[model samples]
Target: MLCQLEDDWTLFTLVFAVALLVPRSPLRFCGLVAALYVLWPAFRFRQAPPWNARQVIRPAGDTGSPMVSVIAHRGGGHDAPENTVAAIREASKNGASGVELDVGFTADGVAVLMHDDTVDRTTDGSGELSQMSFFQLAKLDAAAKHRLRDAFAGEKVPTLEEAVEECLKLGLTIYFDVKGHADQAAAVLKELYMKHPALYDTSVVCSFEPRVIYRMRQADPDVVTALTHRPWSLSRFGDGIPRFSSLWRHRWATLMDVLLDWAHHHLLWRLCGTSAILVQKDSISPDYVQYWARKRVALVAWTVNTAVEKQYYQDVLHVNYMTDSLLGDCDAHY
Candidate 1:
């Protein structure tokens, strides 16, 4: 912002000097340019940008340390049905910066807002999502498993379109978790983005699969892609290494794959800075938190649930974002 202001001021000064040197140059034009250069930011500051970049540049909201940005895990899973419209709406009410929801594809090749391949756990249905049509999937009560009508009254399954609309309606940001086979997620996201061009600025596309994250970028070069991991997924961590072969280009032949593997490994090693150190709940380590914070990598963790856990992340370890299944009332603790 300062650089931008400096450039504008420089241009205005140049224009004013040129006007004085040229005898017939319009004084009104020069004055107007100078006035605009000074007043433009004032008008912008008054109205404020959506995220209010000016406020952050000036250091608002607990500037003492790394900001505590709260991301709703599966849309505040405890407050409402996990990964459903009702839950996302409640997450907005709780003042979450971003709502993270998972995506999978249906048998009919339509994109679905689900976390698993099978609907059995989250909905009143059985079998793989690959075998179901959108019309067939739509009939099942998404919240049936939660028995949420006792609290929420009436909740139903929502399409991705519906989910996006609710976020836009509430002026809430989203951290969409693209799951399932990389190709399926990529294809669905590519098709969906066409329907919501306005969402690009406010949404982040992330996945445990780097290929999926990369594919999201290939679809929309401007989309923000974030890396994610699940410690429990055996498919994710295989024999002490990442399962995905992030080694070679599909468009390349055998010769390039070997060279690329070395490069990626070197890069990964460099990123695993200061060696690995484990910190249990009874102990604290602020330095470990500061490490990722310095890297500007939006550090996040999963299913954190206690005050001790939250403090370990925010006050001690300093994690940037967290997904929780049951923890609530953060404003009270923080």
Candidate 2:
């Protein structure tokens, strides 16, 4: 009900702004009609189903420390070249218990570390990662665009196996942020977990795509999994007004997006069998954390950086959190 009110109020403000700009009666009336059309559905909006509030199963062999776990986001991107070997080492050196890295596949089906669909942003290359072979990708400098390029230049993109090896050697937990190519990535992760049983204790596989988390659980039920979610308002529309849709098709799509966002918060855990929920810091509240905690579902917050944010999630909420900064009051907790 509150969500609908917020939406309607936003639409009303937009309509008022349009009224000020248009002196003519016909255009202003059209704008008013469009606003009313969009706002009418708010009164008929149905609430999402309540959370069932069942006990959540903790992943097997996950005997991690009880203290708040400080996960390094993208291998602490603020410290070193993200998703590279140097970043992994730097994160471990800064006392991070675990390092998160994004995983994607090459054209030849080899799993590698990459956040974006294309290599153009992070590497000295231009192409979709899934279209380039491992050999071709290895030649490009992964750290070319980083702020500390001079210190970390010539760093090559590390294969998934190579990244696991480095994390194992450093005794840092591995948090694989599965970006795409789930089937191939799942196969590789299953192989690694089977060969190196320690990963079952030291690693977690997480994704915003529920299908990827589901696939990981199916392939290796013992592999720890976390469902990543950010509300649609933040994820899709940010602070801007929702895009105006004249056609019914686009309006229906928008309604579905709203429903899905509600499901992510209220129902996704039951459907996906995730052991933990990785949510954006702003989307979480003390009550939200307590609800999941009672159900034995761990809550992991992401990309928290400031001292105030760190203190709230750690000291007040007592939930695990990931951060881009490794050295500060945040790392002290680790």
Candidate 3:
């Protein structure tokens, strides 16, 4: 972790470090308890050696076969209520390769499938999700106010365990976006990992927090952990600059989208020990990807929803994986 943590994990640490400081805790891991109500994620996929059997991309137009899994972002948010079971099951039926959803703890400490702290966007309920109990949350509608009502008027907010069982039944893989604080979130993931070993194989813990990723990596390096990034996260590494221009204004724009450079290599060598990073490919320019690749950083893009986006990642950008909203479009098998 980039930030140092206390040696002991305790209630004091929870009260002072997480609650009073950092500030993001209350918004992320909502509720708290000693059991199932305590919110969390699973560490199953991390057990696999991700780099062991990397697949080389087949040439384009292998006639667009339905080979690899298509990952639906938040239950393919465009088509249904984001994160609802109906939405996820819908994704499975659509032949999606897998589903991607964000999770956060509720006010009472139970982990739930939620992308935000406030429920106003996706539910009839208002205020923070952390403020409610499971029964109270269940009473509110999970359906958003789009064309998806009526069919999903009574969808209950899904618990992490419930989501896992449903996904298991569909025989699908998942990439879990654990959006929260470092240690607490890790604690939650650890709890789930102990409960379900099988879920770890096809799941990954993703976040913008390097500390969170590092902690999870330390606990279980085999689990797949992808680092989300804002431009600031790349700054110290040195190669992250130069996005001050548009692609037309930028130099070396052929492919890889250049996010790092020779300067970055020297920069990362001084700090990170290694230049290779697990990053979301969508946020950066092709030039940025080229820059990071030059620094030996492995790239993975997010929310790839169209053929053009797919082409950008596969044919033009050549990233490690294109995390898309649909399963049939992507081909990351390893």
TM-scores for candidates 1 onward, in order = 0.63, 0.75, 0.62
Angstrom error of the Cα, residue 83, model 1: value is: 1.1
| Candidate topping lDDT | 2
How well does model 1 score by local distance difference test? Answer: 0.57
**RMSD of model 1 against the true structure:** 14.9
Q: How many backbone clashes does candidate 1 have?
A: 0
Give the candidate order by descending lDDT.
Answer: 2, 3, 1
lDDT of 3 by residue, 1-334 (tens): 2211121123234445444455455545344322212321232122235342122111122566423335677777666677878878988888665677777787677778988888888788888877778778878788855356877777878988888778878866666677776676777777777677765565667665556666666665555565554343432222455644566544444122334332233322222222134444435677877865553445555656667776666566665343434534443211
Question: Candidate 1 has which clashing residue pairs, if any?
Answer: none
Instruction: Return the top candidate by TM-score.
Output: 2
Stretches of candidate 1 above 4 Å error? Answer: 1-66, 147-149, 235-285, 325-334
Per-model tally of clashing residue pairs? 0, 0, 39
Give candidate 3 regions above 4 Å deviation.
Answer: 1-48, 51-69, 232-298, 318-334
RMSD of each: 14.9, 11.1, 14.1
Clashes of 2: 0
Task: Give the C-alpha lDDT of model 2.
Answer: 0.75
Whole-model alpha-carbon lDDT for candidate 3? 0.58
Candidate 2 wrongly placed segments (more than 4 Å): 1-65, 233-253, 329-334
